[model samples]
Target: MQATGSSHSLALRRGDFTTLIEALDYAAKGDTGVNFYNARGELYATSTYADLQVEVVALARRLLGLGLEPGARVGLVAETSPHFVRFFWACQYAGLVPVPLPATMHIGGHAGYVAQLRGLIENCGAAVAMAPVEWMSFLEEATTGLTLSFVGTPEDFDRLTPSTATLPTVAPDSIAYLQYTSGSTRFPRGVVIDHTTVLANINDMASHGLKMTEQDRFGSWLPFYHDMGLVAFIMMPMATQRSVDFLGTQDFAMRPRKWLEMMSGNRTTITSGPPFGYDLAAMRVRPSDAEQWDLSALRVACVGAEMINPEPLKRFAEALAPSGFKSTAFLPCYGMAECSLGISFAGLDEELQIDYVDAEQMQEDSIATPLDPEEAQKSKRRVARYVDCGALLPTFEIAIRDEHGNDLPERQAGVIHLRGPSVMSHYFQEEAITRECLSEDGWLDTGDIGYLANGRLFVTGRRKDMIIIHGRNIWPEDLEYLAKTQPGVNYTDAAAFSVPSDVDQQETAVLVVQCRERDEIKRARLVKTIASLVRSEFGIDVVVELVPTRTLPRTSSGKLARARARLDYLGRRQAAKMQHQPEPANSLPMDEAMPQVRYIA
Candidate 1:
């Protein structure tokens, strides 16, 4: 396929543009539609819009031959490849719902991931599971005891025979696909999205949001399992009849600069990832590398799918300044899979809006009170500042609600409630959750903490009490499960929570593992082991602390209290810092019987 703009020359323009099938139909007319690249940033396979149409038809025919019931779910667990993109389009054309499972390998305990997949398949009633050859090993293990109908590699995709008659017809409101929610459980929640919802979101993004065009060359390393990756980068460009260059998540993780190298090499104009990604790349970039790269074409660099940190953006921009990269390219967006990807984005070609507020007032009053530099100097009060996440999309409605569900005014922190055309219809077979999320009038609760100021949305924190490390959500239970495997550690002996670090205000996870043994060396080794396990399994750094058994307070029902543990950990750290400090010049030391830990303060 051609590198960029020259696509969208031929194709039907009308119909439910909201669906992936429709996006494929439009992209088929373009001279260049979808492009895939290898780990070295070299083109591996190329296909024009016209070629996509042919490949999709044949693939859809083969899928239909599988004898899957109408609307049966087909799961894809492979990384981004020509096959991955082709199958997605084919599923749309063939009237089957394609559930794109995350391609990122689960670390620490693989069994947990398998159990999660089993739950998703059971919930979606998936008829087939497919992956690349490398992924087949995990698929086999995951599906071993289950009565699954079919499981194979991508090569087996072509072996499908088109049997019987044409595939079932689908309407605009028909379910298109199911994206599983990331955190809070081992069992994933399947988000049901429809054709209407998809198109409405894409159009809103392309027109009022990002203003994407045929000239834009998309580049991404986001996992295909993610909403931002699947809907925004993969489907949206096709919906707009544009071509995009793809990179694998593992390749990007191993060599983040490859993402920038691709953009520099291809003169690609758009890309997005979490703050950690930028931070990683920034750390690795030397002055020499910047001199060799030219990234002037970059227009939109979206930051989302995790906590947004401004420091990384600043560091990255400064590191690449010689390469003509502008700080203005950093776009902070707020979205979730439940809303089909994007709900709000920082306006393109506009200056970012940041507010410096008193942190104490924010916690106590839930009010964002801006403070001057002078007053900030006199108090221990710190400033919490962030770039505005722009205004809501045209088809979306946003409101902030208090604990009583009453809407709050601007600058007041509250839960972000929204209703939009892009919102998922429901969680598959989960009526209670569906009702709890949706209002009687049809709004989807985004489970995010934020406020509106001058019509701009600024996200503060997540109300869900989940930890998002390295762009992947990990529930406290998942970590607790791993802790129980270690000797002397039980489910009740582990408490996992996210804590802000001194280096950066963004949260880093701290896992406290309770132990009966008081041996300092043994305790230290366990801490190191837990940290290593977390790092290797999830590609994230964790701080592991050991507490004496019975020290961790529990509830009346015998459940571990995560919130209380967080407070206790904070208290311990504070006390430790105080013990190291000298006594006041005029003050006498405390009594010998008093707690020695108090001396540090």
Candidate 2:
């Protein structure tokens, strides 16, 4: 049966159920379900809620026959497919905790991927692991020395006989799933969430955050492993009984326009992605094709998962304006896996609100002093623009704290601490690390630097990513943004950080930019232009180096790996010094460099 049409037009609102199991049981009574699409916008697999419930119940019984106890960890390689979905719900029904492993494998980093998988399997102490037939080889290699009860493909899992034993009783406080943080797979921390926590988040996001209605339908290409994808798109839609359309991440990367086309065709109302995804679609969409599609039904296009760049949102809105797209549909949100998914969301049907601040004051004084538009235009002063990510959700509170644990007043930048029912219980099995971030008072240090202005949160940058240069705090994103505005640099093509200067052994800002120019003279000119731009804008002299395109490494979620890039820079510098060879002063050619190499000065 196709995954479309509601069997009954019952309009069930949020907060009608308290747990995901309860929500899914209510949803299965309807005909609404999920639809998967290919790169060319063709439907491949469809499953209704009723169909999924039947499969999940049967699979849960079979899994119980494996002689595993309740609360056992089941690691599932998260690819966007029917198998992953079936196995996830089966774990839920069997009272087992499901852990979604990332499906990404770096091109030449096979060993690294294996190590990452092994670390996660060991960390979660998973009793069983499963992957698709195509990924069985990787799983086999990763489980070399592990003591897993079973490690195989979905087909192998299906061969097991069902047990007549009764399923374990699951409560609201029972463990739901383990969601690992996106970056640094070598040292992964699983966010321990329960049915109560996740359901609370979903209810808030549906009722207060998105104001989701029965008419809303979800669509996305985000990978199922990411919290925003798994919780927001998959779990949230299922809870609300909303039919959703899915496109694989690889397919979306290959043909970005297909995302818009699917949304237009499916009349998807609620969808979301990071800023880079919108930017990519904006670049690929042609103005002439706008009239051929309809997007007026799209009400909320949520943006989060990374730093929100307004320029790209503007570009996307303007490019799709002819298709009846409104810029007001853009909803900038603040969230992390620790909070289950959402912390705050912008008001619906409102235009994006940006706070322009004095850059020098913000960096030097830890204050986000607003700049008047007329004064900003008259005086050629540096300004940093941050999007207002709305107020805290219901039953949530935020505190901005300084390094000494003193709470700062509004408009003062500091570490963002959040307290709510949605926050994770703890980092799985890492008590010391959990204590470092989570306080006994039930507050979670978000590790993000931001300020509150009239109750709205304006995220400045990451607290750990702040570069200290001559006692002045500099956010790397500011330097990267300045570099992107220069000719030939894309949004994610620049990574900025601070390294110890060879001459003075003091911290100095270094901007590593990726350029497409092949000619040596033009490449040098691009470097000069970027250096001059930074010096003029921020009044700091930065060591600027230009490398070939795609030289910078990115995290699995597509954000620049600033910390990794810094380590890479230090390693390359140490290697060059050990060889008694002077570092290349200007452009670094990718052909002669290591895979992890980027422009270093």
Candidate 3:
């Protein structure tokens, strides 16, 4: 991928304002513009503005008749479907705020889904909670005792009356949507972005960052609830008057190849997902499959929303190299929901910049001193590779600040602070929490640690979750990655965290590995192997525990909730000490037998 510098910019039209309603009007003009696809590789639906306008108008009228005021919050719960899209548009057309609720976890079972739904509806203060008919019984139980104005299924959408109330013309600065931060319950934050903010983020990303064209086709299996899925892929195409090919999130999960196939089949020029998604597809896309499909047009393959793993990116590039995929085409970006999606994006066709730093210096001085990978191998606290997240989006400003809120110099690790028009207005009604993050002039404390090098941003890890052992900041992702290398482990199935030891003055880092192996001998071998690997590689002592798979807590976007995992671990330890309850598969125990290692004083 060759870097196409700032020379690329598309002129914005006056009518093509920040409001989504205005964007939809432009998309509604043409027919044959693709909208959605179901499993089995079929294009299930297509809609022009002319067609969607009719449905949105009727739905708007029905919403008004419900006696809810304009801008009342409506909760949306469903997998990617035409109804979800239609209802979303209807909310915008009728001036209702749509808060997208997370769907059920595939592995969390029914209880987990119910708990998630309950939290979202309660947080958003929804006047209506909507889902499909199959989910009605569960929704009823989940939403019990909430002040729900109405609860309906997708079928009820057809029954909406043609709108008679005057459509409310909202300002660009009016609240457009709410994006929830993907974290544990203790750190739940809703990014409240107005229409102007959303529009600016989208336009800047599409025009300058992504370099999107009307001829470019988009494809994704990412859930609509995720920021990348909702704003970048689904909504950006409509905002830019370009067509998108979407695969259902469930379908893609069930059959990962469908994502690659859709890209190959549709000749999709743009698509984005995390490193795991790429790894999944690369693993499933077999030798025989290559001759049957073509992916010559794929352009911007983005990696974000989680810790950027360079290994998977490399493997994906090698696997698809035979099919005309370039390694340089991989765009590694860094963002949070608080910033309305994108903060920094790599250049269009640039190779990912990875900085190898002295790990000991990083922890002791908070400065990432460049180190050779060879030299790092000999030292106990040696090397760590920090992936550059490219440059800040055209309209956003970023700074690195120390604990005292003083700006730091280049290559010095500190909290990544951002101030931009695209940043959220505030956390929803949580002024205290909002004030803690946002400054008086609108800069937000991202709570992430990184540094600037050669005009690029390099993300280290979340400051709150950083593991300190013998004065070294060991990133949990690094430990979790090593744990995953053990057999019988699933993706995102391990949690590496720090726990306060009874005797140690500081925290003792423990790794909880989830595996399907139940045989005691096999489990012991796995645990011992993990411990040996950690000690040999990082020169750190760790407690390794083998638990059942699919037990780690995950946020709405399918990310591991590290903070929640630590709490769960502590609770299990207390219960075990009390001898009051048997340990459940959901919570695992770590070995307290390992001796702590000594560090150079």
Best candidate, lDDT-wise?
2
Local distance difference test, each candidate: 0.73, 0.85, 0.76
Q: Is 1 or 3 the stronger prediction by lDDT?
A: 3
State TM-scores per candidate: 0.78, 0.96, 0.91
Q: Compared with the true structure, what per-residue lDDT tens digits does model 3 show for residues 1-601?
A: 1111111133333224769888777666654244666678777776654577678777877887787887788888856877777788788888888887776574457887787788878888889878877677777778999888888886775675555768889778878877777767474666787888888888778877788765677788888888888888667777776667778888887888778877887778888888878887888877778667677788889889545878888888878877788888899999878877888888888888888988767777888899989866666456778887899988888889999999999999999999988889899879999899899987899999899998899998888888988877788987887888876675567788888874665678788876666455666677778888878867787866565555567766767788888887776677666975443433323333321111110
**Model 3 misplacement above 4 A:** 1-16, 32-34, 106-108, 185-187, 378-381, 487-491, 503-505, 580-601
lDDT of 1: 0.73
For candidate 1, write residues 242-274 as lDDT tens digits: 668887888886787878888888777888877
Each model's Cα RMSD: 11.1, 1.9, 5.4
lDDT of 2: 0.85
Question: In candidate 2, what residue range of length 10 has the lowest lDDT sum?
Answer: 592-601
Candidate with better TM-score, 2 vs 3? 2
Q: Summarize candidate 2's per-residue lDDT along 168-194 as a digit string, tens digits.
A: 778999999999986542376899999
Q: Where is the poorest 10-residue window by lDDT in model 1?
A: 592-601
